[model samples]
Target: MSIVDGNPNVDTTVFYNASNENNLLYPDKFHQWQTRNNFKSYRQIGRFSDNEIAEHLPVDKDKTVVLIGGPDKMGSHWIKALKQMGIERSQIYYEKFSW
Candidate 1:
């Protein structure tokens, strides 16, 4: 399983289940990327808290996590959470984007 950031600016942690498209902050963009990449499934999670973010991650030992956010608090917290969950540094990828 792979986790990506849906919207880093969101003040609260929001899980994008995809089952409920209306709850996703960037449904169109996320859908486009997912389709273009030809991924069978994807999971998006937006959060500012490390513990909260960690709770939503997959427990698999080999899960890959991709983070798309700034290099600030939001991104750092996610990285921290992933680390706490025992995901190796090599399994993580960070992409910073300017609004």
Candidate 2:
């Protein structure tokens, strides 16, 4: 297994390396990127604090914030902190992995 760091700054996209594991990623089977199959040119959060995340969040209220991680308590804390920073529930998406 390998974690494909989408951005050097943030350790997001903790996906398994299908090629290395000889298995196919479920989403990639149906929807595939035309180019790099990953995001490009976005700054990394690098596991920054909730305050830092709030500070760096774009001013555009329409922007969506996605927080993904394993089923950990830290994710809940992050949500709470973001809410305290005035981030709306509609603007945040939290995805937790069981495995």
Candidate 3:
């Protein structure tokens, strides 16, 4: 597994692996980012075939919405839709060479 700090100012961490495991694991100090940032409320929309990713998305609308996957064409499609929905690219983190 590899860990990455998505942004310099943010303490949140993202984990990825070739086995198709990708996720943002919040540090204890950044737990507030999960709550205060409304990460608990956003509904997670994922590809029908990607039940694992969909299951991790926010169940409510107040949480930070997450779109997970590699940079494959499918993931790119989701990224585009997310952008259309006003989600900043910075908010969408992916692992290096995840595709």
Output the number of the lDDT-best candidate.
1
For candidate 3, write residues 62-89 as lDDT tens digits: 4454546565765676677656555567
Give the CA lDDT, 0 to 100, for residue 53 in model 1. 53
Residue-pair clashes per candidate: 0, 1, 11
Best-to-worst TM-score order:
1, 2, 3
What lDDT score goes with residue 67 in model 3? 40
Best by TM-score: 1
lDDT of 1: 0.51
What is the lDDT for 15 in model 2? 22
Tens-digit lDDT track for model 2 on 26-91? 445223321344432222323455665666555664654555454557568777777777778776
lDDT, residue 24, model 1? 48
Clash number for model 2? 1
Model 3 per-residue lDDT at 37: 34
Q: Is 1 or 3 the stronger prediction by TM-score?
A: 1
